[model samples]
Target chain A: MSTNQIFIVDDDDAIRDALGWLFRSRGHVARLWSSAEALIAGGEIGRCGCLLLDIRMDGMSGLELFEWLRENGHDIPVIFLTGHGDVPMAVAALKKGAFDFVEKPFNDNELVDRALAALDIHHQRSSRQAAAREVDERLAQLTSRELEVMERVLAGQMNKVIAMDLGVTMRTVEVHRARIFDKMGVRSAVELAQLLTARTPKPD
Target chain B: MSTNQIFIVDDDDAIRDALGWLFRSRGHVARLWSSAEALIAGGEIGRCGCLLLDIRMDGMSGLELFEWLRENGHDIPVIFLTGHGDVPMAVAALKKGAFDFVEKPFNDNELVDRALAALDIHHQRSSRQAAAREVDERLAQLTSRELEVMERVLAGQMNKVIAMDLGVTMRTVEVHRARIFDKMGVRSAVELAQLLTARTPKPD
Candidate 1:
């Protein structure tokens, strides 16, 4: 049972207390904030998990806080708690990048479920990002000539064909191939290709 | 066993035949094309699969083909097959949206494994897209007032609170709530919130 963290930022004490208790009862780690300002003051922006925020807080609206998080490169999935007449704002937030929004008087079970789903998304995104970073780091270690050879090798080109294409000797291509394998820490071309294709580039 | 489809668009007969045999042996369905023109003429855009295209073809270059695919909204993951001295072009293609590129004289096993992985990516992307479409269709069914009520109700607001916030009678709010539920085909606020949160919106 993973104790997924749930962050709640609402101005109302009762609402915050209710959410905190609800999440805790369901085996999640719950952290509460009285308002968006308090959440910002706490300095936990990059924490991996889900954020439950009230759309119309006293100072620094949820949308404002959401923008700040995004601008600062925080990818925490946010579910906004909207007040009456805030549907348009919530929809705008959805378009802007909030994970989802629940209106005030939301169901405890639904909110908890959504939070869990958001946490899962965060985990998937971060894991892929980590894998991509690893690939990028390994790729950066290759020289231009070695990189060219690596691409051809993964394409299934033999040393002779690669040599003919590059107008280089077969021995040179072989040397580059060996260096590429060593640098990428892969024994076979199949392993190298799998690493490159396994993770899609992160969306902009 | 799932026979994932692999699309091979290369002018070289030997290369295409080799890739086709390799993928088929690995239990994948391989479709071969001699040129980008032939692929476009076939009208197979938007198909759920992966594409292996040669970068420098006879008539249409791989980069040109990839741009055409993107312009027409084809999301097929494309892996380019480049010839000697095509590393620069391959790197440019990768930056421009091609999945990954392989050099000429490519490895059969490496290419096959990469194609399989790309096919898996296509499947995951398309399924998520289908789910987002479902949610958008459901959301479109609600009226403005009903949408407002729906948002608030999903926020867990009571009828009385919603009525007070919307400056409407409690009975009116209740009527709108019933109509919203009927339109959205959901029984409770929890169900509604879950339905809305289940799919992330497609990125622009």
Candidate 2:
């Protein structure tokens, strides 16, 4: 990921400026935007950090921007900044997967704490994606023949049986097996199977 | 593990009774109590369900009960019921791992919806724990010798290599390997390895 960072989006100059200063003082690269539209325009789309969005912005409302982020497959954790009347909207957004919301006049400590928590979640997700991508790249390196041998090996098939099924010599199957293991960066079929299985998403 | 259920712990009799009727109407077996102490006395500790707890109770406060539940290793998702003044407490409890909170005079539909959502999360966690338990049971079924063979198998060692390490013949290693597969309910070493890997928890 990146260093602990926070995106503060609010139409009000005072609130956004104050939040930016608060987060920056805490050693975060606080990105201040007057509205969600400006945030998108600034090309902060795929950054790894928590977002502090005013629930009721002048343009591209925070909730709408959150919806857009979700639709576009972004998983950045969001913390909504809300007035008392907007608490319900913030709560509704939470159901739709916003990390949390801080009521306006939010305690400086509390808001900063929540942002840090969201950053932790962002980091967790980023590393998991990186790991999955690494595995995928390795998998993409296997030849068609190596891939076929890999599947049978993972299925616990013996070399002779796999060779017969593919109408190839045992030695040919063995060679493919070695190459599959090499490309997968695994010393054995069990390790390769585990490498893939570890990335499987559990039902939520 | 059980049908959709909701545990309502509130000091107010009317609120508890109303919530009970509401959940029962939704086909949930709601267990309503006037206090957290009553619920604990009723032996609902290990039940799989959503807990609707009022932040302030007569005997044991809702937050106290939540803390107790956590310290005792109970993980039923909790939703705090708060009045307007209690929002801060509810938010604090949320930061401490409460599932969510419903502000009072809360919309009935939204409250029930949140509770059901909590139940969905409960079900997900319960199933994951059950899967890990099943794997543990299967692992416990292995004899010491078979377990040694299983470990080497998962490590991708060849039968001949395992035999040499165990000071056994190739036939002996083969027999142990087959028995380990049978006991683990897997057709292949790769399957066994994947089963174990799937239960591994990712860093959070």
Query: Using DockQ as the measure, which candidate wins?
Result: 2
Candidate 2: tens digits of C-alpha lDDT, residues A5-66:
67888999998899989988888888888988888888866774889888887768888999
TM-score of 2: 0.82
**Number of the predicted model whose lDDT against the real structure is largest:** 2
What is the TM-score of each candidate's chain B when compared with the real chain B?
Answer: 0.76, 0.84
Model 1 per-residue lDDT tens digits across residues A28-52:
8889999888888888755648898
Which window of ten consecutive residues has the lowest lDDT sum in model 2 chain A? Answer: A84-93
Q: Tell me the whole-model lDDT of each prediction, alpha carbons only.
A: 0.75, 0.83
Q: B1-204, model 2: which lDDT tens digit per residue?
A: 453678889889888888988989987888878888888888866774889999877778998999988998888899988775344454466657788877788888988888988999998888788888899999999999999898888888999999999999999999999998898898888889988888786554
Error (Å) of candidate 1 at residue B195 is: 34
lDDT per residue for candidate 1 within B33-152, as digits (tens), equals: 999999999876555388998877899987899999999878778887776633234434654666666776777777777777778788887776777677788789878888888877
Q: Please tell me how candidate 1 rates in CAPRI terms.
A: incorrect
The root-mean-square deviation over C-alpha atoms between each candidate and the true structure, in angstroms, is 27.7, 3.8
> What does the lDDT read for residue A83 in candidate 1?
61
